[model samples]
Target: MASSNMNIPSGYVSSASSPDWLNKGDNAWQMTAATVVALQSVPGLVILYGSIVKKKWAVNSAFMALYAFAAVWLCWVTWAFNMSFGEKLLPFWGKAKPALGQKFLIRQAELPATAHYHKGGSVVETAMSEPFFPMATMVYFQCVFAAITLILLAGSLLGRMNIRAWMLFVPLWLTFSYTVGCFSVWGGGFLFQWGVIDFCGGYVIHLSSGVAGFTAAYWVGPRSSKDRERFPPNNVLMTLTGAGLLWIGWAGFNGGGPYAANVVSSMAVLNTNICAATSLLVWTCLDVIFFKKPSVIGAVQGMITGLVCITPGAGLVQGWASIVMGILSGSIPWYTMMVVHKRSALLQKVDDTLGVIHTHAVAGFLGAALTGLFAEPTLCNLFLPVTNSRGGFYGGVGGYQFVKQIVGALFIIGWNVVATTIICLVIRLFVPLRMPEEELTIGDDAVHGEEAYALWGDGEKYDITKHGWLSDETNHDNNKVPSGVTQMV
Candidate 1:
């Protein structure tokens, strides 16, 4: 524990004062974690989405991520946060209320009561998860998780969804879908009471986003035939840049879930990196062996799988266990994407722009189940408030705990499928789910009246006819064409 009297850095901290209930170290770390998590969506996914799509769809792809982040914030504070973590309204949800009111925001952060369970659905006692920080810190931290989940879902629906429908989808899904998972798993609802161990949101965020993204992709329809056949990233370097942010930003993600700057947090940070690095290597090795060449995109996919896989048990598993999860995450998702997806008729029908289903949904489920299998008893005791929670390998109640994880995952999958489908159907009544053919063909230029690139001279839009050296030069060399215009090669 950091001493209360620790020297404060000058000018960096706005005020020297802190309340008795607050630990300056915890509060500082919490706020820092929140900011980095926010980075994963803004510049992180934003850049990745923009650069990975075809040049024409770049702006629209990036805007979807940006819009979801902004819209979630408004919904989060107004009522979504409380619906996720406030007082219980049902076994799987919390009551909705504004989190911005000073009376709620200024108080010490409090977690909902989770009931302990033994084998066969027996409850031990209810435990409250109280953190030493102001309510505002908790709200900010949780909101980022909510925001990123929506942004990730946008990955599948990218390239073709109507923007107006997407704007409406975010708030409704946040309110109806995300909140239910948030409350049920982490907010001390029935799943928590039943001894499910999601150290972070393996099921809540990754699985939910992946499943929902795929569902939305089905309803919104595939990208244009041209795009589906040969869509190459407009900027691989920029995609790498965004992938790097998401990789590093995860330090704050797994570390901050403990809501403390403690031993578990340190272990989580180490395990997260270990799993990601190992998974990346495994994926690269497989690619080299089979394809005779390594792919940067494949490497990024491995990195993501590792991250999502470790999330559920980051603080609840040992270092060695993380490596096991990593190796499997890397291989399993790779096979699914490379082999299973190609062979399956169902998978062929849906055009998931970025393969989010493989990276997020499959890898997420793999991680969740592996967490149940390998969760260290000592570590689980440290991270989970439930007295005897442990993974399957630990024996006795451990096997039962693993089963609980599977059950929890099923609930999440079912809910997201129903919720996402309903949300899409509702939005379609007001607006078309798919963009018009003109907009689909023209991409960013048709939708936003802007293009991502201006390779033409003087920053003008490219015009094959007008800007062609032979076409215009022959006619316009008579002082009609611009002075510097040149012929196409």
Candidate 2:
């Protein structure tokens, strides 16, 4: 029998039938944290993409995000959640099922048998631990992770992608690709059994997104020549605001990975902040030295790389280790994006709109590798029953951990590369990946029927049609041409 008071205080007690304050508090925090993450993908990433893309593609890119946000939720509740976290269907995947029944939602649960088992002495046959929160919370929390993964993939196919093709791709990829990755590592599949240490989503989320995004970009083809020649971010401030949200929202991102508020959560939060800050500082210094001017955009990219690099090790490394990871993440990705990407003909041909390949994929892999180098046995002890061992530098476990990290990362990268390529090729056979040439010419307005900014100052609104600037008769002036029409040269 399970101990009911596993998380509750010993001295004070409440009826099991009645809800406990602590449980309620945990649920609230988890839900809020999940919401914060959801925001990062929706308005946060949506706005960021809108501002970062050339003006013509802003609405289309933002709409892609919005569509994914809504589409994934439906797929998540209906089936994708179970396929990723449900009972194992195979060593590398799980069975797909709907988990939204009222009874299923009401039941309390624990981590599945496939999840990491730390408390028991025998790792080979340890029993699964149960969770305190209702199944509803677990389903919702995992949904956010799934949704964001698809959103991240959107970054690679932006600018010229047809909305219709994306709509089909999101669910198809979620079912075929995303579920396998989630199940293998997180849902107690083969990777978990192999002792792969992904504290959060270094492999499942970032690595998978990065690889899939880069590959999809190749298959989808590049943006128009004109669009690529002068593709400047229309609104840098909006991108900055999204960057701010991403930084703070990571508190939930890494902190909540432990599934409870505890010392590991605290450590994860602190380490995340340290790595991100250090990365930003390092990148800014590099920018000043190279370009003779510090670029805010460069700083934000550094921050993102730092965050991505630290995510896999957030709960497994010490404060000092985090600083090292930050520096490496900042410097390495910077070199890849600036020096290597410019020189590499392969990368130049593949138009990744947000550079997700470098920022998330390369940085995510680097972080995971660093985790092997720096994981503190003490930190692992806090969550799992594994004995604490020093990393390569600490002289305890020389090259074993590093080897394990490489194995895990390669598994993810290779799988995504193969699976994503096949998925895109098949999808492209039926639905075209790129928008029609005429639609591409007019951009977002012709496709999505929307624009990101109106720029009406001080509550002033202008009717473009009423000015006789367009051919619409409803807006034509019956008496004469509108004032500003002839004023223009």
Candidate 3:
């Protein structure tokens, strides 16, 4: 018989409803945190991408994010989640298996392969991560992280990627590229065992997305030449709204990393905001000095870099270190995006629609290295699996930790470059990597048969004469206009 005690307090309970392994507080916080992180993608990045791009690309840009979110959820539950956090299939890969059974969901959340042994022959064993929550909660939390990474990668290929190719690319890249990075950095692969500190997802999410997005952009080629030169945002205010959601949603993004509503989670939340605020101000100041005025877009870019920069050490570093990270994250990625990108031939040749490479990749790598330098020993003891792990500034074996960070970052970069390229190439064999030239000129209406805004001339759809669907006119949705409505001339 299953026990159904609903009012049980703290301490272990034998009831089926209140399992001994369950911590109600942690479970509640974990679910809440996961919900907010999911919000960062559905409405946060969706609005950001929709408004940041030129008017014509708004629908396509937003849809790419929306579609990826839904697709990743399905793929994650069916196979990708286990391949990321389940039984080890290889040093950097996990076995593919369904994670949808009631038996699997009710078990206590655990990272089976993350247990580490000490180098010395002391017979001491570090325990695996066993968060005091049901496996269902863990699955939900990790699924959001996986979904957001795919959406962030979509930022680079927006404004040009073929919808069909994007549809194909999302699941493929998530399986081949994302799972490997997630496993290696966070799921107890070589990097985790060797003491790489990705406090949240600096390497797995940001760095992998950054590198993969840029690589995919390169293969997909540039947007139409005309739009590239004069791509103005469709709605700056809405973009700011989206940015605000992202900014606040990160409270969960970093806070949930500890898998508990404990001191480490509290510290992580504070550090996340501090770094983001400092970076935003620094970026604005730089824009004023060089461009003669504050740029909203530049400030948003700064905020993103700061968030990425502190992610690798959010819980393991002191607050002061976060400000230092913020200063660098704001300026360095700014310089690369504003100055180096213009000078570098390869960068200019590849039109990364949202500069994801600079914001995510560069900042992620920077955060990883800085974490190697700044991770506090005491704080590390609270969160890290490896005992006595300290940053280089703390002396002892810290320098080796720094080297491990670099090696881990390099592995992610190398793997993404290879995996993303192969995925794009394989996608190309089936369909064009880019939309047709006619569709390119017409934007959303041509590709998705819709427009984001229908403000002109009686609110009718795009002028079919100029941007009609190329496949067949009869299939067009707008053709069946209301009886009394007037069509746009």
Candidate 3, backbone clash total: 0
The TM-score of predicted model 3 comes to: 0.93
Question: Which runs of model 3 end up more than 4 angstroms from their true locations?
Answer: 1-14, 120-124, 461-489
Clashing pairs in 1: 469-487
lDDT of each: 0.88, 0.80, 0.91
Q: Model 2, poorest ten-residue lDDT window?
A: 471-480
lDDT of 2 at 221: 86
Task: State candidate 2's TM-score.
Answer: 0.89
The TM-score ranking, best first, is: 3, 1, 2
TM-score of each: 0.92, 0.89, 0.93
lDDT of 2 by residue, 190-302 (tens): 78766677888999999999999998888888888877776788888998997888888888888878777778989999999999999999989999998999999899999
Say which candidate scores most in lDDT: 3
Tens digits of per-residue lDDT, candidate 3, 1-489, equal 335545554355667877877899999999999999999998999999999998878999999999999999999999998899998899999899989999999999998878876762345468889999999999999999999999999999988899999999999999999999999888878888888999999999999999999999999999989878878888999999999989999999999999999999999999999999999999999999999999999999999999999999999999999999999999999999999999999999999989999999999999999999999999999999899999999999999999999999999999999999999999999999999998887788788777787654434544356553233343344433444556331
Global Cα lDDT for candidate 2: 0.80
Best first by lDDT, ranked: 3, 1, 2
Each model's Cα RMSD = 5.1, 5.1, 4.5
Clashing residue pairs found in predicted model 2:
109-131, 110-130, 110-131, 114-188, 377-388
Positional deviation of residue 257's Cα in model 2 after best superposition, in angstroms: 0.4
